[model samples]
Target: MVVGEFTQDVDVVVIGAGPGGYVAAIRAAQLGKKVVVVEKDEVGGVCLNRGCIPSKALISAAHHYEIMTHASNIGIQAEGISIDYGKVQEWKESVVKKLTDGVSSLFKGNKVERVKGEAIFVNEKEIRVVSGYEGSRYRFNHCIIATGSRPIELKPFPYGGRIISSTEALSLKEIPKTMMVIGGGYIGIELGQTYAKLGTKVTVIEGLDSILPGFEAEMSRLVTRNLKKLGVEVYTNAMAKEAKQTDHDITVTFTTRNNEEKQITADYVLVTVGRRPNTDEIGLDAINMKMTDKGLIEIDHQCKTSVPNVYAIGDIVPGPALAHKASYEGKVAAETIAGHPSAIDYKAIPAVVFSDPEIASVGLNETEAKEQGLKVITGKFPYAANGRSLSMNAGDAGFVKLVANQETGLLLGGQVVGPEASNLIAEIGLAIEMGATLEDIALTIHAHPTLGEMVMEAAEGALGQAIHQINRQIK
Candidate 1:
């Protein structure tokens, strides 16, 4: 169709085929709305193809290799453990293909139309989708914008051949012999440690005093210690200034916190400073949607935008730029559009980092509760005392800490840093969401010789009845 020559009308139009967009489209369809989703590139968005899924696949392979090579501690010896980068790449791609195909099948099953194109808002109720040399106008009863975000390109280190972004890092056929990571956040820590396990020398540079700044200091210390064990050098309070790249190598210049300038050479520098919301060039100005200076869309509890009948979710809105968070908001927005009374309840949004000795947390921490002037009690237990953790030969170091109300024993928050932390956090997340108290978790019987038993033990410690550890009596 030529520009404005034909108009496709729909009950609801979702302006991105990412996680949030596709979920919103299917949900709208389930609510008896004819929905159409537009995407400029892949259907599964950054999470499926680049950000979450692919990186995790690589991390899994790296972790398996690391554990298999060190099996001598369990009297299991392997002659050699090596990673075939090509095979690893293929496996990662297979994982992505399976997921993206599932998302496509979901759209088909839900009768939601998928359009491949970049959509620019023509007005409040209309959009012009441009794909190649062709264009079409879409008019809808309501619109849900889930355009997502992109990696922020630092001026000092523009991404290219030698200075690459996380997207490019995940796709390398042969892992670089040496790599420099320019951020200490989850992305930098995960990938940097991954390559280290794959026989690459990795160095991480961070502007803050510590890497993984969002995590608690104690949790970060555990990760930092393990990163150092992998021989990944971390330079905190260091600022990356510039990169001079040749065909085969690059020298990166950075300044230390004490105003000391330094330089290091590496095959590639992976920059993961942060992400920027993709709210520009879509003609958001056409509807004058209220947005923050950094391009985050402002929305109500149901994700309703300033303009009527328009909603925005995912990375384009405030809150953590997490795939699960976006999906949650997508559901809320779809429900609100369908005239349902759905609102966001972020009582227990869990954040997990797949670093060495993985870190995960949900709800309030001791610092957060203290900041909010809430009197709380905390109980902690270590993996060293857990039978399951010791049996698996992962009992060296790690802990689970639970926070609860001082007066009522109501669970306030929980943090885990150890083996299977990602999976273990789910139980506590459900506990917090269901408003279960510390006693509830304490009395619930967890399976014997299972990692989940730590949850109950931690809860018991909170109630001053812990059998696994010496309990400090607290009423």
Candidate 2:
């Protein structure tokens, strides 16, 4: 030990001030533990600062602009509608500042000390946090790692000036006249569609057979149809070979599904393949921490790592790289550290894609149930048959689908593709979480002329008692 240096001791030290880390710090503090958070960048991490919040702001702006430009069909007229993208970005930044500031306020209220530095493990019991020329060590009784993950960079498409990642895509100074998107996962699709609605000529290249491969084919197809309506081009089973950037534009070359070569030019190319866990640089090898072959830290239900006192959550652990999921695990890890029997339950983790009309799902869909050898029954109700959807001009857009055990009528899962899908999926998530059955959802009377009624209607259809749509009689 240095003569002038002293090690700071805390009851809990959390790495990364993102959704997972900060939440863990607050929960631990609430449970009477001295907490310290080590963050390399901004306090809110990528989700609030660069990813989720900012992108959603832009998506909302684009959606409003699209609606205003085409309101004539709804017995209303909007004229001379234009978007000042500069103002849009400023407003988006304001929204981000408010949320990040709120998180910081919560930290201060909870008395969690935040250290702005990069944290590296010194051993199983201590860590060195370095900020520029200064460095400090923290000895913690327990540690929670919520380091999260980073966007995966592809070899063929190294990010630079014109080839940008989502982090850069969200902060662009000006909206491009044309944009090329690589990878058609949720991130790419969301951003691509946002720009498309904003009047940018957008092209999407997906390596798989379909975009949003994690979602149901029917649901994703609706998004694909909407993309075409927005004048966006989509290519599936396509490989992005290379990119050539000029001062004014970027030219991307790729091979089609049939092995034919093609090229497209755009102002910028956005890459959103996936995210990799931020586990490499934190010096996990020093503590001999266990991880998967893919570099994900191994954690049990309590988010406890192999070293009992050290824990990991969020993108570093096995599960979807979602902010809410990380936040949930953060609380569970904090409770477990406080000697509570808290554990993780992943049965009802809802995933939502904010594309045009949105797509949301929770638990097992029909295909998944059938693959697992469970006798399943499915019911679907189109948005067109719902009065609220018709009144809202979304009648031809999407539908609600429900999946359940045929024998027991227990709700297994639900998928929604339409307006307010993100909000509507929560009911299904709660249903699955509480072990609610089809009859439970159907028997609960939903208010008339509301999108929520579709849930009840879908449930009723599954039981052969649908009112708005034709029912399927169980033999």
Candidate 3:
């Protein structure tokens, strides 16, 4: 039963309090706009509560566990190390709870009103929100929608007891002895690798020719090779047909690339194929908002929708549905709504994967630059050549690649597939955003005995100069 009725008039109303929504709300409030954020679930949204933060906590735990159990090579030995999944999950939940609570506190501190409910557009200027036992209406001069996306469920293998999504995988009580991961995207590979490190026999079947199809094959090769070391089997050009749930285990049927039928049995089947934007039933069309054929909201450079006073950001818009991307767009929308003349820019958006050695990329890679018919020069420096990597006993893996214009040496992009790739990509991303050159990076004095030195060395190589590695000419 609806328990309450209320009405609120505000300068701006932000929908879906995910990273994008909350950031937009806070920025709007800071700009002297009376802002209210409407969130159906928790304030932190899926990234903090379900996807990014929780998964990273679990991955960090698994990484530490691997380090503990496999430190014999470094003269550190442990007779046995076992996973306490209940405790691990408890710790993960605690981390998530802390971050979510912080988001709530920020909302209060920013003077942004919080309305707990599922909101739908009642008209171009108003929306109706229903919160469990309460209902309310809100009218706004401007509206911003930051509704995020969710994991897509397959038709044949619907999410349930034996079938699960990443959310369910993150909350598992015990580590499954065996698991089959369909769709070898970054999500599949990361989680599959995580469980494999924890002693789960992971089999990844991908419809593409290679796993992590979105990344460069050479970059993915490093991860796939490490997966082999972890005893995780991967099958490419494979199609998962259906799944059968039984009392003991789940049997998943698939067709191999050679057209041979095969079956893999696992405790559960984890599907990480892709995510669909959460753009349904929120009544966007009610506001005469323009949208793509696939339901993504249409917006201008400032994130303004066709309705002028309305805006959309994050997964509901075109681009990779990354949390940082959403957060960036949120700030743009908020600033634009506050009449700050802010605009969206995607030139330096970085993508990072927390796989075995980690992989990160920003700006244009060689393939993309070549496809665009831009003459480019590329250089690579390996972890083996970096003193820091060898000192850490990780010299056997990873490399840093720099892509730059052949004529101008303007830094085009960078690819890092090694330890701390996520952190290393930030410098190059900033360089690209600021339009720096290979000479700029090469001349900069990177700290000695650091992984970041590889970046500088790669820049030198791109300029046909050699210091740490032999310079190879690019035709």
Candidate 4:
């Protein structure tokens, strides 16, 4: 162990260098506050180095490979198509490295001190930073906890050679011939599809009645169809009983919801059950910070924790474990710290799934709206009728659904399950945030031959004025 002492004070100290923590530091610095970000790992955290960027890079490669293999359908004759997994892995690493370096540069540009150490709360306003090479103690006027979360590893399958976590799955040296994904959530499906596209015999085991348990049944059904198209075998309401590793392969024993047991063999197994908050080793108890039953730090609208002069944001607090959600919360916390009355609008935060035909949604869904006792009306437009989707050969799978207040016509929520759904959902999020009525969206003049036009058409459909589809004759 190495020890060094450096005395310095900052207006704000952010723990963790993930999306939320870095964004908070930058925003605080922009507000003319002296900020320092403490990180024990890479500057970009899991989103850039391990999770989002890496996974997307792999998916992009797989998508290209799949398209190239089927080039004959598009009037292009191609032969001798092959994939070099080594090159793909190298390219992905290069992208991650460039982005990580860019983030470090941003910290320098913002004049925020980047400390490479693990921070433990010594008190409300003090922390001890211990590093592998150097150790120091720091003091601050205000602190933000953006420590993020970690993947929950199941006891039956420990992460090693055969059974692995998403982090390891992303860094595989070669695409396994047979793979088993042990989860049905967004992460499992996303990676499972990517591997299947890359020529892996991928099977997904989800311990729920449906894959995306929290999403609407219709949306989940559509996604399941798409997965089947990619040649992925999905087992819903199936629990993995045990994993046995042999010299040649790994066998996973699972039990179905009906109490029938089965076995499957695979070269690799990915466990993407879920993530848990990283509050265990942060010394939150020492600072007397209040946490919920799930161990998430309790915060108000402004992200203020129970301890005075301390705040929390991102996955450490409540809400979805999305990077953008955390980033927005970080900005709000920073602005509030700078004496700028800033509050977060949780209703407008869009959640996106980067699957084949993607999924995106925001605000209240049908069940939530009904549970709230609001009089709601829903409108849907299938992509099968859209011109651009047909041109892209992606028209058959999904549709866009919009929910509005029956009397006021005010947009309440939006859900999409089609190509570029993630991108199209942003418009609805903005509209909902601005409190736009159905007519406001219907008259917004969406461009022709684009996915965004569907938003307008859906809104118009709700108002009984859609041009492409037959109007619903309302009594």
Candidate 5:
């Protein structure tokens, strides 16, 4: 069957429906621009459907299950503690469905056209979208590429029934008796911890010398300790050689840093090494678009690609592969396309690890700060000393660390590893963005018995006025 070309004019077109693409489309529509969002899959992209939302849902369920099982020890009597994995999965799927539908309704409410198809660049000013099943073509003006990334598949361990990626891991039909996670990044740690709490014998293997390699060593240590307490076996400085499917188990062969080879058997293997940009199959080269050495779409400060009128954002472009980051970039690109001066300031973007206790940070770490030759003052307050953490029965370890300039007291960076660390790091990120100093943060009255007080305590400690802890006056 032959189909005729259909052309449609729009003020702005967004090519991915992930967090970035959808947000951009909605923002452009709010600005009174006729917008169309072309997505090959579901709206809300990976974050709402798979990556962030689903993973967090699983983590929350795991946390609840763990709490209920241990409720007796906390003086709450419970009987026949067990988990129905099937029901848990149903609940998780329901959450994802609700959010995805919400995103679709949002697009409808904002009058942003949602096209379900793969969009290819026919020219700088035109795009041809092939409907997945219908094989229809729709042309649009000024498109935004928000196509996200896919998990990087290791050559030795290809995805299959026994071997899986994060997407498959999230929708596991049944929890494995034993699982081997071949990565120590945030994703691996998060999923690994979730499974461990749910009664899976979980092991994490990392090629790096330490997990969370980008974070401070102290923070990583805290996470490691917490994970160990959760019964997760973490093997750092280890490389996976090969995986063999046995009659009853999957055997993973690895080499340790000390040149020792070992084997571990697990029912499931999750390969969460990292993600690669989804730049293939969209006919990028056909339009002569430039990409970075790392295969990310090359874009300027205004999110303009090498080709004019073709803007790209999200995982396809360079920067942290975070949903929020992509969303911001998407808006910037839309605004710039709308003739507004918008630039992305990458300095204040926050990164979070959703493992048990969680880890969130923004700006520079101590290592980066020291390498820049800036004298820094560091302060820390432990969760054990926090009143709220103790009351929640979640306070055993973890703390908040603030790094600032020694002379100017300007906040350089912040890290939090504890319950709701993901949420608590926001205040620190705001302070860094506002160039808040130690005194500025210390003077601000944080509510008592709250986790946020840790931020104030850390800042006060930096200024040598921490009232709750030992005070060492800065002279």
Candidate 6:
């Protein structure tokens, strides 16, 4: 049968209804523009459907299980604690469904049209969306591309049989007895620790000298210590050579720091080295769009592509591939499309890793500041001294480190590694964005017996006026 051709016109058409794409669509609609979103699969994309939400859900469950099994010191004895992983996955899927359904409802409430299909560019102002046997063309005044990214699979360890990616790991029906993680980045470490807490023998092989090379060595050291406590083996300065799979298990060969080759066999192998942009199959060249050698789209501060009527955001653009960062870029792109003069400013974007003890950071660290030729003063406060951390049975968990200007006392950056580090990094991020100084945070009286007081204590320590701990004034 021959298909008929029809074209629909809209004010804006957003491709890939991920966090970035959906946010862009809703915001464009809210700004009085008729918007239509085209997605190949689910509305919430990978972050809601697979990556962020599901991973965090599993992590929370694993954390609870770990705490219950080891809380005898706190007068709570949980004998014979067992995990029903199938039910855990069911609960995880329920959480995902609620959020994705909420996104669908928002699209309806905002009157943003959603077309389910794979989209290809016909030109800057026109696109064709095909779903199964039917195809439709869309003509728009403006377009935003937010297709996001997928995990990178190494040639030696293609994803099949015993070899898996994060997506497959999250949806596993049964927990593996043993697992091997290929990389030691946030994704690998996060999932590795999650399974370890749930009673799996885990091994991590990192090409760099340390896991999470993006963070400070001190912060990474804290996570390494926690991983050891969980009985997880970590190999830094190691290179993965190959993977061979059998009917029963998979074996991975790698070279160690001493240039010795070693092998480990496990029920499954997870490769989470990094993510590659989803730019190749979208027909970007049809519109002559500009892209980097790394396959990232080149866009201005306003998220405008080389094509005047086209724009891009999120993981497709250069920066850390974070869901929050993508959502922020979406808003900026939509506001700019609405003629609101919004531009991207990433001075205070925070990055968080939900490890055993979480690690979060924003802006520059001491080494970065010094490399940039800025004289910096540093302040450090431990969770051991905080009343809240001590009461919470995590006194020796982690600490807060603050970096400030030596002469002006301006807060430049901060790093937190411990319980609730993910939530605690926000205050420091706000301070950096608001141009708050050391005195600004220290002078503000924080409530007593709270974890947040550590921020103030750190600031006071920088000023040589710390009351809870010995003050070492930065000369």
User: What TM-score, over all chains together, does every model reach?
Assistant: 0.98, 0.98, 0.98, 0.98, 0.97, 0.99
| Residue pairs whose backbone atoms clash in candidate 5 | 18-45
Candidate 1 clashes: the total is: 0
* Candidate 4 lDDT, 1-475, residue by residue in tens: 6667666778899999999999999999999999989998999888999998999999889989988898888798999999989999999999999999998999999999999889999888898888886778778999999999999988889888798899999998988999999999999999999999998999999998999767888888888887898889999889999999987789999988888999999999999999999999988889989999998999998999999799999988988899999999999999999999999879988888888778889988888899999998887899998999888877785999999999999999999998889889999999999999999999998888998889998998988998899989754
lDDT of 6 at 142: 96
Clashes of each: 0, 0, 1, 0, 1, 0
1-475, model 6: which lDDT tens digit per residue? 3166589999999999999999999999999999999999898999999899999999999999988998997898778889999999999999999999999999999999999888999988899988888889999999999999999989999999999999999999999999999999999999999999999999999999999988999999999999999899999999999988999999999999999999999999999999999999889989999999999999999999999989999999999999999999999999999999899999899999999789999989889999999999888899999999998899998999899999999999999989999999999999999999999999998998998999999999989999999877457
Which prediction has more favorable lDDT, 3 or 5? Answer: 3
- Runs off by more than 4 Å, candidate 1: 1-4
Q: Give residue 40's lDDT in candidate 4 (0 to 100).
A: 89
Per-candidate Cα lDDT values, in order, are 0.92, 0.94, 0.92, 0.90, 0.88, 0.94
Alpha carbon deviation, residue 1, candidate 5 (Å)? 5.5
Candidate 6: Cα lDDT at 427: 98
Error of 1 at 153 (Å): 0.5
Say which prediction, candidate 4 or candidate 6, comes out ahead on TM-score.
6
* Candidate no. 5 TM-score: 0.97
* Candidate that beats the other on TM-score, 4 or 5, i.e. the better one: 4
Residue 429's lDDT within candidate 1 is 96
lDDT of 1 at 102: 99
Better of 1 and 5 by TM-score: 1
